[model samples]
Every structure is written in structure tokens, then in C-alpha cells.
Target: MKSSLFKISVLIGIFSIVIYACKDKDNNEKLEETVLQGTATIYVDQTLQPIVEDQTAVFESQYNVKLNLVNQSESEVVNALLTDKTQIAVLSRKLTKEEENHFNQKKIIPKITHFASDAIVFITNKASQDTLIDLQEVLNLLQEKESKIKALVFENPNSSIVSYMNNLAGVKNGQKKNIYSLNSHKEVLEYVSNNQGSIGVIGLNLLVQPFEDTKQYTDKIAVMSVRNVKSQPNNVLYYKPNQSNLGEGLYPLKRPIYMLNYQGTAGLGMGFASFVAGDIGQRIILKSGLLPVRIPSRELNIRKEIINNK
Candidate 1:
């Protein structure tokens, strides 16, 4: 009887150990797979804030999730991701090789999803007679060559627009004398609207959906159509950063928008990334005046009988 009791106690101990192990495994799985119902913080490029806010609103309403968005300059966004401040970042450009190396050293591979196409637009005061700008002229201004515009105003020195223009113009060091960096896009708009001969460089998203306080300032400014210098045969077509122009690649200053997820697990970051690349998120992009990565499908009904014209 003593031996049998000892055997029963051993069996109970083994069963309890097995149960505990299984429970721990289940808990880990739950933590890894909780995609639609958790809290996540995302760093977003300030220029893309308007459209991203729209996406987060619908996503949070549909799922039991909370998204905290930190809108900063593109450089700050990249810095936050590299420093592990956030696992997800929305940017106009992909990570550079050096940036990827940082993640490689940490054994973290980022998942990048291209969601939409955005544009860098130039705006001036409505009273300005120059309604059209040549792409080459803008580059010349960046290169410190003589140009029609007196100065170029940008939101932030570290913003993506400034970086893009600098790379495009092949500027090695500081910006040209004519280029100026302000605190925010609003200031750029206001500065351009009040000062003639100065042009504001801003994201098309702001013009599409301006804030209530800045609506009047938007009206006071004019969006200039850009003449593409890269077109073959010296094409004379000028295009504005409208939906159709951006979709057809006619816009001269177009950039791709991407969502980079470094969560390395099936969490809310993954879920939000999927949501942005999915059908509904594309629709949101369409409504926000930017070109969706994939055009949403439309179903049309056909009738055999033709209706009489009224």
C-alpha cells in the first residue's frame, strides 16, 4: 500500500507539471497572435498624418484595438523605429541599407508594405502670376543656380521633403541660401501666403484635407502645376498633383508611401499593416485625394434592354 500511494503521488506530480506547461504554451500563443485586440503605438511621418488619422479611426472602430500615433518629421520617425520607441512606422520612403543593418544586428527583420502614392507640391500666394513651375527650375533652385523663385520654404529641416529635394539636387552639405526651414507646414503656408516670391513645399495630403484653422490659408495660396523635365521628346505637358495625375505618373514630384512593421510577431502592428494594404484602407487613400497602391474594384450592372433617353 505504501508503494502504491507513492506511485500515485508521482503520477499526480507529473500530471500537474504537464498541465502547467500546456497552460504556459497557450498563454504565449495568445500573446503572439493577438492581432485585432491590443494596444499599439505607431510613429507616422508628419506629412502623412491626415490620411493616417483617417485610417486609424476606421481601424479602431472596426476592431477592439487602440492605436497611438506619434506624428513627427520623417527623420524622427526613422529614429524612433531604430531606437525601439515604436515597432511600426509610416513613411514616404523605405529604410536605407544602413538603417536595415541596425535591425540586422538586432536580429529583427522589418516588414514593409506599400500602401499609397503621395506627392510633394509647391504652393505660392494666390496673387502670384507664376501658376506653373518647371521641375528643372526647382532642382536648379536647390542647387543654388539662378531660378525664378526667390526662396523655398519647407516645414522642417529634417522632413522628408527637404531630404528628397536635397538628394534630387545632389546637394552635399547645407541647403542653398534661398531655401528656408520653418517649424511646421502651417508656418510654411502662412509665410508663403503673406510673402510674395517665396514658394512653400508641402505634402499634398495637407491641401487635400486642410485643418479647420488652416482652411483660409489654403484658400489664400495657389497650387502650382509642375512641368516634368524627365519626359521623353521634351514633352510640354504640365501636371498638378491631383488624383488622376498621380495615378497616371504624370505628377513630377510623386513618392510612394509605406508602412514598416518591425513587431516580428502577429500583433496589432501586423494587423494594422494588413488593414492599410487591404481593400478598405485603399479606399481611404482614394477618398483622401492620393492614389491607392491598388485600385479598388467596381462592379457594374448590365441590362439587356436599353432605356430611352429622357
Candidate 2:
């Protein structure tokens, strides 16, 4: 009977070990990721930092998740993604074909979520009398051709705005003598504010929603309305970068903002992308003065009977 008891005890210990092993296996299968729960690092284009910060604040407050956003220049963000430093990024434009093929070679599928429409804005010192600029003049100035623009200040050469303007002007780079690049958008705005006849090219998000420290800089600058001179000359009209103009496709310098996920699993990247493309996220974008991909729906209540008050 003692021998039998010893054998039974050995069997029970083995069974317990097997159970614990299976539990460990199950836990390993799940990476602790769910729709509203997980930790993620998101790389955002520095120009879009303000708007994204608004989205992340609301997202974390309502969900059991923590998001760490690394805001850098557009090139830096893309380079980080390519080098496998990160799997999530937000940019003003979608990934190019070459960038997509890099992941394709690695058999990693990318999820691109276009959430909002953002505008590239031209700002000038409030003291300047020029309130509007023609698209041709801007392009010509970028091409190193003489134009009415005295000086064009912008973010660094690697920034998305510089690329957008260069692409518009059909140039590889902005080598114009009058073109100047600063370390950041804040610096560009400050320079424009302090200098006369300097147009600061910046993202609309910065001007529309100013942070506490940047409010003074924004207060001293004015958005320069842009006229699309390439289109019908007689019917040309100047447009300010605003939600209405972006939604109507009337804004001359606008781009789609995309959330790119290459995490390859149903991870935090997926959750944040869905959130930004969802109703609540869209509402935040709307409140941020940009155009959301889908305007969040509204519900109204109607009263059929009214009571009179004495």
C-alpha cells in the first residue's frame, strides 16, 4: 500500500507540472493585447504633433492603454519604421511604393489608415500687408525663380512641408537663395513674427490649435490665403486652410494624414489605428479644426409637445 501511494503521488506531481506548462503556453500565445488595452509607441510627424496629442489624451483617458508618441521630422519617422525601430507611425502622406516593398520583402503586411485631411499653411507676420499669395508665385519661388516672395521660411530640409513644396514646384530641393529652413515650425513662426516680408510655411494644426508656449507666436502671425493660379484663371479664388475648405477639396495645399501599422499582429498598433479612424477620433479631429475622413454622425432629439411656463 505504501508503494502504491508513492506511485500515485508521482503521477499527481507530473499532472500538476503538465497543467502549469499548458497555462504558460496559453499565456505566451496572448501578448496582452486587446482592442482597448496595450502599450504602444507611436511615431508621429512633428508637424502633426498637436492634433495627435489631442487624440492620444482622449484615447488613454477612456481606455486601459498607454501610448508613447515620438514626434520627429517626417524623414526620421520613416527611417525609424524601415530600420525596425518602430512598427507604428503617423504621417501627412501615405507610404510610397518603394517603402511598401521593403516590408513586402520581409513578408510583413502594413496597415494604412487615412484618418484626417491636413492642410499646409503659409503664415506671415501680422504687420505684413500681404494677406494672400498665388500658387504660381509660391512654386516659382521654390524653383529659384524671382517672385514677389521676399523670403520663405520653413521647417528643416527633411521636413514633410519642404518635400511637399519641392514636389509641387517640380524640384528636387529648395536651393533658392530666398528659401530658408529653421530647426522647427516654432522657430519658423517666431522668425516670421519677428521679421517683415517673411512667409512661414507650416502645418495648419500648429496655427489652429496653439499650445501654451506657442500661443504668443501664433498670435503674431496670420495665415496667407492661397490662390490656385494653375486652374481656371478667371474663376480663381483664394482659400484659407480650414475644415470647410479641406472637406470641399478647395484647399490648395492639403494632404491626407495616415496611421501606418506594421506590427504584424493584432496589437496596440491596430487598436490605435482603429480608434483614430473611428467616430470618437474623428470627432477629435473635427474639434481640432481639420477634416476627418468620415464626419462623425450626430443625433438630435425632437419634442412633439411643449409645456408653458408661468
Best by lDDT: 1
For candidate 2, what is the lDDT?
0.88
- Whole-model alpha-carbon lDDT for candidate 1: 0.89
Which ten-residue region of model 1 has the weakest summed lDDT?
26-35
What is the number of residue pairs that collide in model 2? 0
For 86-142, candidate 1 gives per-residue lDDT tens digits of 889999999999988878888887888999988999999999888788888888988
Expressed as tens digits, the lDDT of each residue in 1-310 for candidate 2 is 9999999999999999999999999778754776678778999999999989999999999988899999999999999999988999999887889988879998998888999988889998899898898989988888878788777888888999998888888899745688888898878888988987788898888788877878888888889989976569686689999888888888789898999999898888888889899999999999889899999999998989888896
lDDT of each: 0.89, 0.88
Clashes of 1: 0
Index of the highest-TM-score prediction: 2
Q: Against the correct fold, how does model 2 do in TM-score?
A: 0.88
